[model samples]
Target: MQKEYTVTVYTEDRIGITNRITIIFTRRGINITSLTTAETEIPGVYKFIITVMSTREKLDKVVGQIEKLIEIHRAFVHEEDEVVYQELALYKISTKSLESGDIERLIRDHQARILTITADYFVIEKTGHQQELTDFIKKLEPYGLIEYSKSGRVAIVKWSRRFHEHLKELQASSEA
Candidate 1:
């Protein structure tokens, strides 16, 4: 059966690397649910976090192929349970909706907080799983949701303890 997987890749910062890495999935008919790229602790190095739905066998092979890319240093595939992930969502609603005060209750119940309140709109921020963010949207629909934005999945492998060790290994290998 196919399941959600988060593929984490460490690589050197270079142009077109994102396109090159994503094409591998595109060719395999894998649809990416989320993609996030950012700098790593190491200077000139970067990390790519990709979320996809596929079977373990296929994902293993895909990860192998990703590692073969010239710029990729390493790639790993993780099951949902193996990683702790969150997405940040911001909701902007009309200030007129607050007169009822029900919106305040809903935000507190959902563990979301108001970030800013202007004469026209108020913004609420929530950080959680995808389903939670979607649920919040449903709850806010009655409040005249002006804009809703969410960030890509940011995750950390629950069992990862070798990150530093792996970085050292990469450094040593690059030096040799």
Candidate 2:
């Protein structure tokens, strides 16, 4: 059986690293649903958050292969419930729609905020899981949405001690 999984990888900053990491998934014929890469709290260390649909068995193997890369410091696979995640979405809607009774109602109901208002359109910003963000779109359609953009998922593993903490633990064990 196949289910969604988020694969998190920590690596050193280097050129062409994204391409190299993605090729691993491509060669395995696994379709990546989302990919986000950003620098970690420590400079020169980057984290890659990737989502895919696969069985636990397949994903475990994928993580192993990812860690085999010389640049990778660590890689782990997580089920959705094993992590905390969020995505951000922005919607641009015609200002005229605001005139329609209670546009404020939709905004409040979705817990979204108007990012900016202009002569033509106003932008609304929302952050949540994918389904929540998609739901906001349906609620906004009647208000004459002009544009929509969403950022890839960002997540943190639930059962984690900081990566640095883990490193310290390893060092302690080695010294003992």
Candidate 3:
């Protein structure tokens, strides 16, 4: 089954860096579900968080391609359960379709903020995983959807050093 994979790329901050990364996806005939890039803590360095849907083999090939890029310093693929992740979603829903009290309860339950409100519609902002946001959409569907937007997954290793240690142990056990 095709599953979502989060790819993190660490690279030099230079012109066309984004284009170079996107080209890899394009060449592989993969579509990026979501992408976010920013400067890293270190000067002259940048980080990109890209979410894509593919099989395990495709994911591995994509990582290899990313690492081969001249500007990319490192590239890693993270399984959903192995990483800490979050997504920001903004949705405009029809207020007329829901009871005020029910809508208020949903807003509080999802920890969403109301950004704007019209007589018929209200914009709600939420932050969580893809599943959480998807569930929220289903619940609010009764209220009618006007528009929706979601930011890509931003993730980091949960037990960063532990992961490295586990790899080392596995290698040692295999070689013995």
Candidate 4:
């Protein structure tokens, strides 16, 4: 059975690494639902959080191919329960909508924050799971949603001790 999986990849920060990683999915015809990449706690190392819907068997093979890349330190495929994650979404609504006081109530109810208010529009920010963000958007549409965007997932594995130890070992080896 096919289910959603989050593939986390750790790699050296180098040009073309993103392209190389995406190409692996492209060749296998796996569609990426979302992809987020950013530097890690370890300097010169970066992490990629990719969401896709695929079978565990196929995902394992994909992770193996990703690990074969020279720049990649490690790659992992995690079920949803194996990690903690969040995504950020921003909504821009007309300033006029704020007059009703309902907008403030909505923000407070959803635990969202008003990022900025201006003559023309106000921006609201929410950080949560994908469903929560989308539900917030639905509620905001009636209040004059001018625009909205959501980021890819950012996640930390539940059991990351092994990865951190691996990084420490690499640092030690490099210093020798």
Candidate that scores best on TM-score: 4
How do all models score by TM-score?
A: 0.93, 0.92, 0.76, 0.97
User: Every model's Cα RMSD, please?
Assistant: 1.8, 3.1, 7.3, 0.9
Question: Model 2: per-residue lDDT, tens digit, 51-139?
Answer: 89988988888788989989888999999899999999999999999887578888988889999999999999999999999988888
Give me the runs in candidate 4 sitting further than 4 Å from their true place.
Answer: none
How much is the lDDT of residue 125 in candidate 1? Answer: 99
The residue-by-residue lDDT of candidate 4 on 20-117, one tens digit each, is 99999988889999999998888888999999999999999999999999999999999999999999999999999999998899899999999999
For TM-score, candidate 1 versus 4, the one ahead is 4
RMSD of 4: 0.9
Ranking by lDDT: 4, 1, 2, 3
lDDT of 1 at 8: 94
Poorest stretch of ten by lDDT in candidate 1: 159-168
Top lDDT hit: 4
**Global fold similarity of model 4 (TM-score):** 0.97
Instruction: Give the whole-model CA lDDT for all candidates, comma-separated.
Output: 0.92, 0.88, 0.82, 0.94
Report the number of backbone clashes for model 1.
Answer: 0
Model 1, 58-97: lDDT tens digits are 8888899999998988899998899999999999999999
- The weakest ten consecutive residues by lDDT in model 3 span 162-171
Mark the regions of model 1 whose C-alpha exceeds 4 Å error after superposition: 169-176
